[model samples]
Target: MPQVPIVAAHWVYLLGVALIVLTMIWRANVVVPSVLATFLVALAWTHSPIAALGSIFNASFTAAKELFNIFLVIALMTALLNALKVLRSDIRMVEPFRTVMKDGHTAYFVLAGITYVISLFFWPTPAVPLVSAVLLPAAIAAGLPPLGGALAIAIAGQGMALSSDYVIGVAPGISAKAAGVAVSAAAVADRALVLSLITGSVALLLGYFAIRKFITKPDDGLLERWQAKSSNGELARIAQEGTFDKVELARGTAGDQTPLANQGQIDKALAAIPDAREKWSKIFAVVTPLAFLGVIVVMVLSKLGIGHDLKGGDAAALVGGVAAVLMIWASFVTDPLREFLDTSADHVTEGFIFAFKAMGSVLPIAGFFFLGAEQGLSAPILGVPAAQAPNLLFELVQAAQHWIPGNQVFVAFGVLIAGMITGIDGSGFAGLPLTGSLSGALAPTVGLDPATLAAVGQMGAVWTGGGTLVAWSSLIAVAGFARVPVFQIVQTVMVPVLAGLVTSTICAVLIWH
Candidate 1:
């Protein structure tokens, strides 16, 4: 690739960063700025009005293509979660864990631990409801505040665990792509693991004490007090009422349909009916976990020189394939052959619906960032380069690297902080490639492992933007789901998040150095 002149495109890149920062400071969505910046940058670079128009479409579409895999994983996992809910296995899966949630402290750690593991495997969007639905009530019952439950999950799943992205590989894929490194490279994965653990551990400990101070003894009167103060009581009541209505309808239908049937026949059918859900659910719960575990085992074995070599998309394929098989098996066990087709279709449709609804806005937002990478978009920003394709952000980072010393600690912390600041835009992922590239460039100067610094940067960017500390980030979704104030979530998360970042940064300096 030929080097493109930085010139006007450099200023355009700075302007985009400014626009993003300004939007973030105002707690507004960065989507508009991203789109407008991509267009203007492309327009200025190409100087051809026609090309500018085309770049806008190209940037967004290219980004969508690049990120579609991530979108699919989220969708499939969500679909799987919803399916589990329908089978009621979602509830049963966590029932045993309730026994461990005997106190606020216990509940706090348990929720965090469970969320970290599950989200590590499936991603947070899908894992949220499962943790909330089953474990939340248990945590509340064990004297953990609803806010505490929320805090634990955000720290573990959204912040620490997701920052690394070991199993799903979404974060790594994006970071590596931006850094011009190979996916699954040792440097990126290893460093990401270390940094993520440091941050997550710190965040978890800080959150524990904050909750401890607020925990009330498990008194009967406390439930009433909490209900009185509960911002979400009405929502819960409405949901409960809706559930009751469904139960009532099922009972009425059973009564009406059973009339004139033999008592023995009716008894046998009713006995078998509950068994259908129970039997199939048991099979699915047992089979799904085992199947997923088997895939992981196979993947590990393959990495170690067994079976078949799996590369890009294979990891996702393994997960999706297993999920599909489980979906089919569950459908079959629940109904006869005739019903299986209908059930499968219904579930897949539901999965897609859930997937799109939750993530529709993200694609366009991602497209805007994706625009930064392409020459088609750059032509619109910086007049025609004879033969060079401009990388706006990467060029900016490289130009500025000389001003900053390659102090390993400083670079790691600086990148981490820059990532956290970018996350203020509430789109944690928008600037990863820039950070990742910068990390790689700076790493050689600092005598540091580029991957480790990149991973540290990844941690800061993701944890903040991914919803742990930022009120305006996806924390809104968590607040909405938990029926708590979004601002309160931010307040509760601040100490823990800061603690996590500091610990992770210190760990990087000490251990990696």
Candidate 2:
């Protein structure tokens, strides 16, 4: 086979990625560097300065269009959570779990279990609010440290559930597509599931032990201290400005004193709920979980080949649709008939604002990486035919392939590190195509299964960028909800997540090579 030429633009892309990774390690914002690098790479590849400027806009637009579903699901789920809050059904959802949580030791695992389950079905984007709003306070009240609560949610929801993405199938689907494999998404999903479990269990256990010394006896004082701490953080400013309400809900003091106008509105909203309708709060609480549970059961049955399988985006849509309907039902039950539509609209608007606040920064960063993936979004902007569009990252990796050692161990770790580097942008799934493409290319050279390599790469990308090791990722949501500093949570989970990644990679080589 003929060798592909290595161009100066390829080197520039590599340098750009290295700088982004270094910036992240230094605990600095990488968005500015990412945007600059995208412009430079586009300028070099297209040789047209004006076209390069256009590429920047096109890249971010493509990223937002591709990821808009994630934003929508987050908004729908958040809206559902807001409606639940009006009904106080959010608290009811976790009341039973609180009994089993009992103390710090049990609370840690309980939080992880519930978070993992819900995130697996609905994606962590949606599940985080529900878990944080309801179970987080319960876990805190049961003696889990605020940081501990954050770690459990990050490792379980973002790391474990998202890496497998078995129910929604998004992660594996992306990986399989990039690998150019004829295999089913389930082939990737199965391996990812086992690897994620190993990684998550190891990380969660190590995290628990690290924070064990900080655990205190069950006390209201712990919750109060956390609330105070949260009030001083970046998210607090949003809440103080009255733009965010979920923070107060997480602190379990939404009814606390506020501006009279705000208080009056809250009082009026509560008063509108007649005594008979109050029963619907508890009823919906029970029905909501059952509805979601049924969704999961049907998904599982489909996966087992007993029914039509809901794959990839279809599964996410199902969950989002269900949540939207539930939001409407809960809103109607909590307000007068004439006011329910307005109430629901307000909840949805708040949800969209929150979702954008949490994830808007990701768009530009994702755009830069998406360009490297030959996603076709930049072809028109660069004035190139789609077939001739450059895949900057893939070409660079292919050029360097001969220099990579033939050792399976070396290749596995190389892919793992590459995945981790790509993850520095802090959108875990955005880097999947790059890693998956590399995994497929390198696996044959190293005598390893492509699926196993893909799973190992997924582990690194999702675990690190997925929010456990990175402060600026979705981990911020975990930090915001748990009332802890984002970097502190990152510090607590770093060693454990690294250890888990190393161990799981080694296991993948042994089990599947």
Candidate 3:
């Protein structure tokens, strides 16, 4: 087959990607550069300013369309969590777990384990709220520092569970599809699961040790400190708005209006509930976890070939459907039947708002990357026929193969670095296709298994951009919930995440080859 020529447009795309990475490293927003890069690359490729302008808009539109399912899943899961909160079942759900988490060490692992499990079924975007709201407080109260609690959630949920994405299969699906691999995403998913565990374990252990010295004895004083900090922070915001009433200001002065006050009120209300209603809360709490457990069991059986496999979007749909049903059930239990509809609607709206707040900035960034992918949507936007559509990133990698060493070690690390660079935009899944495509293209040349290469890239991308290393990513959500500065969480996890990625990449080259 004749080699496709790399054009100036390809270099422009590379420059754009490089610039974006540089901006991220500088802790700056990359959106404007991404948008500009998209325009420049499109202009170079099509040589039409009109086409390039349209491509910018088309890129974001395509990204939103491609990733809307992720947004929907996040919304549904958040809505479900909110509904559970209404019945105080969210508290009930984690109350038992708190009993076993008696100290800082135990609390850290327990928090991580629960966050991992929940995040595996529902992506971390949704799982964060549930874990943060319930488990975070309990973990802190059990002697874990707030930053420690945030690290656990970030490592387990965003770094570990999302990187694997075995249950939902979204991450692997993107990779497999982009790679044009004949194998099902299940093949990649299995490998990713193992790699994610390896990475998560190393990172979590390192993280725990790094913060263990800061772990104080189980005391109310630590919790009070965090509460006072949160209250003072809120008071500052209220003061800036100049909206505080005298009574509110006085309450804030006493640090009595802490964020946990809402939870306290909910606990009081739960206590005041009729015995029948209260039983329902406990029942839903138990039932909710079991329902999700059942889903996992079914998926596991399917993975073992006992039943049909749930792949890609289907798996996400299964999770979303389950969450929706649970949301309705919880809403009905918590509110009058007539009000349940409104209650559910309110929850769903709130969930979408939260989802957008967390992820709205990702769309344009995803768009820029999507344009470099061979996803069919980009070709038309660039005013090229499907057959002639340029995959700028893939072509650049392909063209550079001659000069690039063919060693498997080099190839594996290259793919890992590429994935990490793509992850700079903070949507870990967004870059999977680019990494997957590169892995597929380069694996043959390097004589490595494409699946292994894909898995390696997945680890680097997710562990960095998914949340652990990047404060602008979903790590912020964990930070917010833990009431710590986002950068503090990033600093805490940086060494572990980088170490984990390096160790896992070496392992992938050695074990898989």
Candidate 4:
């Protein structure tokens, strides 16, 4: 290990921070700054011109290594979700919530609650269309504003479910890995989950009040507003068939027909098994919940020393495997021979596409952060003297450790806020290794749990970057699907997101402290 330097690489780091801030202020990408910063730091430290060239390649490769698991987790979960959709189990999964959405107020809360729950397991990207397609129209008919529905989703799914990251464990795993802690550490997951819940609940409550008076009685007028703001084109297309018309049209349609008629035949052909409408719906209600519950059971059992020790990537593999199995069973049971193989392939393909779209941007971006992480990675990021090998960010943080406040809450919130600011670049998960490692190094001094602090940092990173707050992130797709202005979605979600952050911070301080 390189000894801490008496003279810090302050100027180099300052330049990096300044560049990042400038990029953010101008709404420009900071990837170049991240790369340039790595180069400068390495060059300045080593004072050799040639090493900068190598630093770039090695830094990105290091980043890819650290973050590949996150990409894989996303790919697997997304694939499983796609498979479920093809099997029609995705629709069946949410059917029970229909009963709770009898009116506007109920619909708003129901949407939030259901979105939060499902997004926790399967994630929000997949859950969004499923919920919006089914529950949204009902919510509108019940007088829930389309904007309100969008806000609820941003708060519950993107903010809460993702930030906590209980099921897939991507966020937590990244944080935990960086902090040198186990991914399934009880204290870590518990605190993160609680903080996420607190923030999400408070934000959602405040947000609902902000729009309370906007809720109207059930009316066709509400649908007009919903249509006016939402992606009317897609909704119109889905509506042309009328509510549940696909199900009806697909019911026992004969094979002999024209293309349109053939579509009905195909729909019937691919349609779920007999009374699958009711039966599969019930099964999903039971099995999906039970499957997740089983995960919890295994977690508890592992905690109690009864089963195989599962943590981090292992836990994720288990969850993904279960989802895949469910997909296979569901698809096969509906139409074992024909639709099974075809649907599985399509779902996996779509899943990979989505996974890349959601996470691929991070490669270059994270390559920038990884440069500051360790010298091994930085070798390619900065052209430097071979003898002067040190992790730039780690070294910088250590140099500043003397000046950092000693309070636990201050330390925790500082990491949280820093993570949030880092997320402003729109690659929310990009800053984890820095934050996590800092938390570990800082934890020893501030008397805080490294895992807990890392978890808090994760919430800031993921909720913002996962598309809840940022217009440029996944929020755009959400807004498009909802048929609303992206900025409108941001403004609507601002209050709730702020509330969630505050509440979650307080919860973390109180509980973890």
Candidate 5:
């Protein structure tokens, strides 16, 4: 393959990525560096401050356009979760899982299993609070150490489930979009699921082994000990991590609305009806789970050629549509007919607000990366014809390809490492575009599939930044719930999570290749 020449913009792009990584390592927000980097890169390319300023807007604008689908699905799913909360069904739904946690050993796996399932559906944003509030105490009483409980939640919910993002598909959607046309979200998601399971299984098993010695006989005092350890140590700051974590859970400030949007009508309806709300809550709890399960079943059948083939975007649409209908139904059940319109609007509004709070920070960072993609994004930002647009990042990769070993496995790990570096900012998602574009660029040179490489990159980015290894990320939320120090969560799970990531990367290279 011919080596592509490096240009001024290409050098600026590298420097920008390096500065962003350094910013993340310093534990600072990457938004400023990202914005600055985009401006500088644009300045280099266009050679005019005015054009660079315009490029900044175009970069972020283009990025938001590409990623709005991810935001929408997050909002709808979160809205559905809020509706479940309204019915109190979210609690009821998971209460049964507690009964199965008969002992400390069982509790560990049970907590992880339940977290993985819930996080897969609604994301760790909602699942963390739900599992921590309802299940964490029970798991603690069953003799799982608070730290153990925290590891289970972070490794399974945030690391494993979120890495794949199979249900919500936010992570994969971003990765696939940045990976270019040859790679589809469905393809990336499918590979991501396998990798996530591999990663989660290894980490969960190792975590259990690491904590098995501390597993005590079930005693009521266990919960007391755990609670006694809870202090105000950075508890207030824990809520702040939710800015990137999807919900301001502990603070209850993500999307707070009035306690009663239609207070009088709702009160009147509840007062007039005898146990109608409770009855509906119970009924919908059962129906809601079944409906989601059915959707999963249908999608599987479609994949098996027994029904219409739902592509990546189509799958997200299906999930979002179902969630909207379910939210409306659940809200209606909880709201008086006369007040239904206003009440449902409140829930949806809350969903969008929460979504923006959690995900809005990624727009600027994504914009910076988008400016480095293929002609479609860069041309718009650089104001060049598509055919003549600069492929700054990809060209750089090609120029440097000779410096990298030609071995696929070597290249695979390199991409994985690059992805992990990108994730240090802790958004878990802010790095997808860089890794995806790198994968697409490097795959042909290495005789591998871009989708496979993209999947590997996605795993690395998500598993690291999705909250498992970072103290300031959503791991703090887990620590807050378990009443442990945030660093303690990071330290305990660090090795196990790293092991899982390494194992998964190796598996991705061998299995998919």
Candidate 6:
């Protein structure tokens, strides 16, 4: 890598990273500092306050554009859930799972096993919301804490399956190309798979032990207690679909947000509900699971024997599309055909509102980090040509590279640390090239195999940036599902996840390297 000019923007970006980390340490929301950092970085880079001001919106817009799929999945999944709620099918859908998930311990492993398998083929981005929507309720009812469920999903799906990317081979392909080694991409992917499982196992084991304390014994109130925390836009408020806190049926309105006009409309709408609610609920409970199971089956088949052609987004798009269709169908079932349009629109609108409420804060924070990434993700935020954009994060990594010793284990762990740093940008794969290049260069000098070193770096980069440890990453999806703050998810998984990464690197040096 060529020497990147150390500019004021670099310093500002570093300061911003520090401020956000400190705010997190203080248990405060990091959004303010993140927005401030983006502004400062822009001012330093452009030397114009006007340009800096525009950069805030630009940064957030860029991040939102990149992460819109996540927003869509959340919205559609919620819409589906809302529709099911009208039919009372949502409860029925998860009822059977309560049988399978007899306890919190059983639910945790069940969540992990299912998440790992789905994420291995479908990618965790979509699978997290899908699984969270279907299985998470059941898991909670079975006595698993919402936070614990989120932990299981993040570690098994994002940290484990994503780190390896075995089914797709995308991550290994990037590393292999940057590695510039004689080794094939498949070879690197194979090694990465082994290392990933080791890391995931360690992380999951430690994570399970840590979260066990939060698990409560099964009881009817366990699920209700969790629901009580839900806001007006959440599943708990489905009964209040249009309105009625105190305004009641007298006005058929509750502030300006009410969708219906009067008691007549309310009664009419209620009357429109199919008399077969119980029967339809039973049918949908069976059909909903079958639909999702089929999606999983088809996704696995589509990707299994293919030559590394799958994209993480494909599964998300597929699931979102299916959820949308199901939601519309359920709407028609719940209301008269004339009211179907209104009801469906209401669900869609609420879905978007909830999605933004849950994930809107993530944009600016993610945008701040994106300004330090490579051109494709950062160029717009910087208002610079793609080729001219500075990869400030990777450049920082390279600036400190010389301090690493020429010892094998140190170099391996050094690459691991570097990978973790570059991963701070939140796109885990974005750091792969830098880590892979470092591995290729440092491994030969330190008596380490580039493939092994590259795999170690892959594990670190993906596990951290992919979701388990970062608030701005796809971990927000897990947070949204669990209805907890993203920082809580980060804090919960940090110790175990880091321990697992460290142990995996040590094993790589001792065994693979």
Backbone clashes under 3 angstroms, per model: 15, 0, 0, 17, 0, 0
Candidate 2 regions with alpha-carbon error over 4 angstroms: 102-104, 118-154, 162-191, 207-276, 375-378, 421-455, 465-467, 470-494, 510-513
What's model 4's lDDT at 56? 59
lDDT at position 16, candidate 4: 75
Candidate 4: segments with Cα more than 4 A from true spot: 1-3, 6-14, 45-51, 180-188, 228-289, 304-306, 330-346, 374-389
**Could you estimate the TM-score for every candidate?**
0.81, 0.77, 0.82, 0.80, 0.92, 0.60
Residue 349, model 6: Cα distance from true site in angstroms? 1.5
Backbone clash pairs for candidate 2 read: none
Q: Residues 334-440, candidate 2, lDDT per residue (tens digit)?
A: 78888998999998998788767655666676677667765365565456788878766656767777897988988889888978876665667656666776676
Instruction: For residues 187-296, write the lDDT of model 3, one tens digit per residue.
Output: 78888998899889999999999999988778767777776665226423422332112112122222211233235644775696667678888888899889888887
Report lDDT (Cα) of residue 362, candidate 2. Answer: 61
The regions of model 6 sitting more than 4 angstroms off are 98-275, 306-309, 405-513
Per-residue alpha-carbon lDDT of model 6 for 137-220, expressed as tens digits? 678877898889989999999899989976545577666645653545666676898889888898888889988998988775
Clashes of 4: 17
User: How do all the candidates rank in terms of TM-score, highest first?
Assistant: 5, 3, 1, 4, 2, 6
**For model 4, how does the per-residue alpha-carbon lDDT over 193-282 read when each residue is reduced to its tens digit?**
888888888888888888788888878677655555524454333223221121112211212211111123334533544575446545
lDDT of each: 0.65, 0.73, 0.75, 0.66, 0.79, 0.71
Q: Model 5, range 178-228, lDDT digits (tens) per residue?
A: 777668998888888998999889999998888899999889787766766
- The per-residue C-alpha lDDT of model 5 at residue 73 equals 87
RMSD per model, one decimal: 7.8, 5.9, 5.9, 7.6, 4.6, 10.2
Candidate 1 vs. true structure, TM-score: 0.81
Per-residue lDDT for 87 in model 3? 70
* Model 5: colliding residue pairs: none
